[model samples]
Target: MSGIACAVGLLSSKCILSAQPQSAGRILLQYTAVRYRRKPRWLGTAKSKLFRVPERHQQVEEEVAELKRLHNVYHTQMKAVRRFLIDEVEASKLVSRAGMVIQTPEEEASEWEQIQRINEEWNRKIGEVREKRLADEREQRKNYILERLVAKEQRDQENRERVEERVRLEKELARNYITRDNIDKAIEMALVQPMSYNFSIDLSGNIRRLGEEQNQESSN
Candidate 1:
C-alpha cells in the first residue's frame, strides 16, 4: 500500500499506512480539490504572471501554433471537399436533366414541317430539272430538223446545178452531132459523152443523114 501511494505521488507513505477507507477517500478528495482549485486562466496579464518559466511559455506558444496550422489545413481540405461535392452533384443533375428531357409536340410538328418543306424543295428541283431536260430535248430536236432541211436544200441545189451542167453539155454535143459524118461516128461520140447527152440525140439525125441525102439528090 505504501509503495502504491509513493508510486501515485499524491500521498506520503505514512498517510497511506495510517489511512482507513474513509480517510483514504478524504485524502483523495483533498488531492482532487488541490489539483482542481480555480486559478487565473493563463492569458493576457495572467499569462505574463503565471507562465514565468521560459519552458512553459515556449510550450504554450508551440501548442497554439500547432493548433493554428491544423485548423488551416482542416479548413482547406474541407473547402476542396465541399467544392468537389457541389461540382459532382451539379454534373449528375445536368446529366439526369438531359436524359429526362422530352420534345414538345409543337417542336416535333415543326421538325416534320421542316422535313416536308425540304422534301417539297427536292421535288421542285426535280421538276425543274425535268422541264429543263425536256426543253433542251426540244431545242436539240429543232436544231437537228433545221440542219436536216439545210442539208436537203444543199443537196437539191447540187442536183439542179448538175442538171443545168448536163443540159449545157447536151447543147454542146448537139452542135457537134451536126458536124459528125456518119451513124458510126455519132455512136462513137455518144460513147464518149454522158447518158443525158445520148438521150438528147434522136432519130432526126438518123432520118436525115446529111451527106447521104445530098448524094441521093445529086444522083436524081
Candidate 2:
C-alpha cells in the first residue's frame, strides 16, 4: 500500500483500539516516507481544484428515523418536567404567602423577648461548661505542682539521709585513723601485730593462715 494509505489505516485502527477494552493489547505504528510542509495563510488554494465541489456524506434511512424519534421523545419529556417544576414553585409561593400572618406591635415584642430568653439560657449553659472545664484544668495543674514539690522534698530527704550515714561512718572510723597525735601509737600497734596477707584455702573451704600454721607446727 501507499504511505498515505497506510498512515490513514493506522490512524483509524488506533482510534478503534482506543474505544476497545484495555485487555486487548493491540498497537499500530504509523510511518511516512516524505514529510510535507504546511502552506502559509497568504497562499490561497491551488488553482487546479478552485472550482471542485465536495461530496456530502449520505445518512441511512433507519438511523435518521430513529434519531428523530428519540429527539421528539426527549423534547416532550423535558417540556412536561419543566411545566411540573414551574407549577410546584408557583403553588409553594402562594401557600407561603397565604400562611404568613401580619403581627401586631405587642406580639412582635413578645416574640423578640422569647428569642432573647432562649439566647440567654444557651449563653448561661455555655458559660457554666467553660467555667467547669477551666476549674478542672486548674485543679489538675495544682495537683501536678504539689506532686512535684512532694517528690522534690522526698529526694532532698534521701540526700540528707545519705549524707548523715556517710558522716556517721566517717566518725566511727575516726578512732583508727592515723592523725598527728595518734601516728606514733598506730605505728607501735602495727609493729607489734605485724599483719600478714598470706593465706591458703583447703578443699573443705577452710582458710589457713601460713604464719599461724607454721607457728602451730613448730609448737607441736
Best candidate (score: lDDT):
2
Native-referenced Cα lDDT, model 2: 0.83
Residue 100 Cα positional deviation in candidate 2, in Å, after optimal superposition: 2.5
| Whole-model lDDT per candidate | 0.72, 0.83
Q: Flag regions of model 2 displaced more than 4 Å.
A: 1-74, 102-110, 136-144, 211-220
- Candidate 1: give the clashing pairs: none
* Backbone clashes in model 1: 0
TM-score of each: 0.31, 0.53
Q: What is the Cα-based lDDT of residue 95 in candidate 2?
A: 98
